[model samples]
Target: MSKRGKVWLGVAGLVINDEGEWLVVKKSYSGLKGKWSLPAGFVDEGETIDEAVIREIKEETGIDCQVKGLIGFRTGIIRDEISDNMAIFLATPRINQPFVKSERELLACEWRTPKSLVTDHLTSAMLKEMASSTPHETQFCVNETVDPGDIFGYTSYKLFF
Candidate 1:
């Protein structure tokens, strides 16, 4: 069986706090409602991934950030039943700005210690990734019986430091 492919481009931010915690948002909309994950969203056409990341951060957290470096990439099946390619980037919050959660995209936004996330409710991959100090590469097809090609199209992005 061949999987029907659909391409998706997304950006995620690894925002760090003074306490060494990471900023994450609790999605309240479709797809992954109530699930804890990094602040992220789909990239608009003609929009650079870096722009998307910064925009998403402000939309979801209402804070300005400076991109630091590429954290890594995460490719997997989303609850929408589509394959998603996400580029994670490390970011530092700008000084003297407060973040207000956007009720449209997030129900709550908070800073969580890396260690706290490991024990609390979080995406399995997110928890594991946070536990590691070094960048890692990982790929897995959910519902293994489905063919990768038929499952989704590959979306690509360029990383900017």
Candidate 2:
């Protein structure tokens, strides 16, 4: 069998506005389309995690933010598709305006509370992680060795309380 290889690496942000609501975006593309998630994207070469988060937010929501801390990390496997890992972080928006940057990649943007977010349709793993009140770090591993191409890639997000 051929050796497993690593592929793309991405980063995302969990930016919370001053209203104490988290930012969620509706993707316009396939895979996770119609799903609400934080503003996130790939980490470009020579870019730090914080830089990636800030840049992604600006590109997606037209809002600047400051990275506060890391919430946790996640790793997933895609049997015949893609496997990926991500870093979630906590952040606060620098401005109070709504999302102005509209792109084909995103459909909509809104602010929602953690409690309300849990009730809404969200990624199972993200919902569980948001429900916890404890401040801790955790990592998830997959049973099968994921092919680099099968890996959805790595992303980092900022979480705010």
Candidate 3:
């Protein structure tokens, strides 16, 4: 099929500590303002999914992380904006350190145990989906408009929704 706009492939990482805390961030973007989700972002050209996941974690949280495995994936279509496929990885930090929200687009980075994760706002669908997945295997999910054509209109930064 001839694709009109763009297919954005992104990555997110579930960086865990020995304490079993998972890394998460609040986006500062106008659309995602105050939304809590995994440390994730777009995959730059020529970047591997693994590399993108690690880089996103570092860039957003200021903590170095190593991709442990492909833990999950989530695809979403922002109608007439972009079609997104996000890879979620299991990761570990290179050094014992705290997360510093480095990017101006990041509001905060924190270690939240599963019990500590809140659902009052827009949290990652992957988080809920992850509960049903075994860490030993990969989990995948598809969300957004079912009509593919309506969503593949143009490259977008609408990943926040």
Per-candidate Cα lDDT values, in order, are: 0.69, 0.63, 0.68
RMSD of each: 7.0, 6.5, 5.9
Stretches of candidate 3 off by over 4 Å are 1-5, 118-122, 131-161
* Top-lDDT structure, candidate number: 1
Instruction: Give lDDT tens digits, candidate 1, residues 75-158.
Output: 665444666677888898987467789988888888877777666755434533444443443222122222223223423222
TM-scores for all candidates? 0.73, 0.72, 0.74
The candidate with the higher TM-score, 2 or 3, is: 3
Candidate scoring better on lDDT of 1 and 2:
1
Off by over 4 Å in 1: 1-5, 77-82, 122-124, 132-161
lDDT score of residue 144 within candidate 3:
39
C-alpha positional error of residue 76 in candidate 1 after TM-score superposition, expressed in Å: 2.7
Better of 1 and 3 by TM-score: 3
- Residues 11-64 of candidate 3 have per-residue lDDT tens digits of 889889989888878888744467567888888778788999888888888899
TM-score of 3: 0.74
Q: Find the candidate with the highest TM-score and give its number.
A: 3
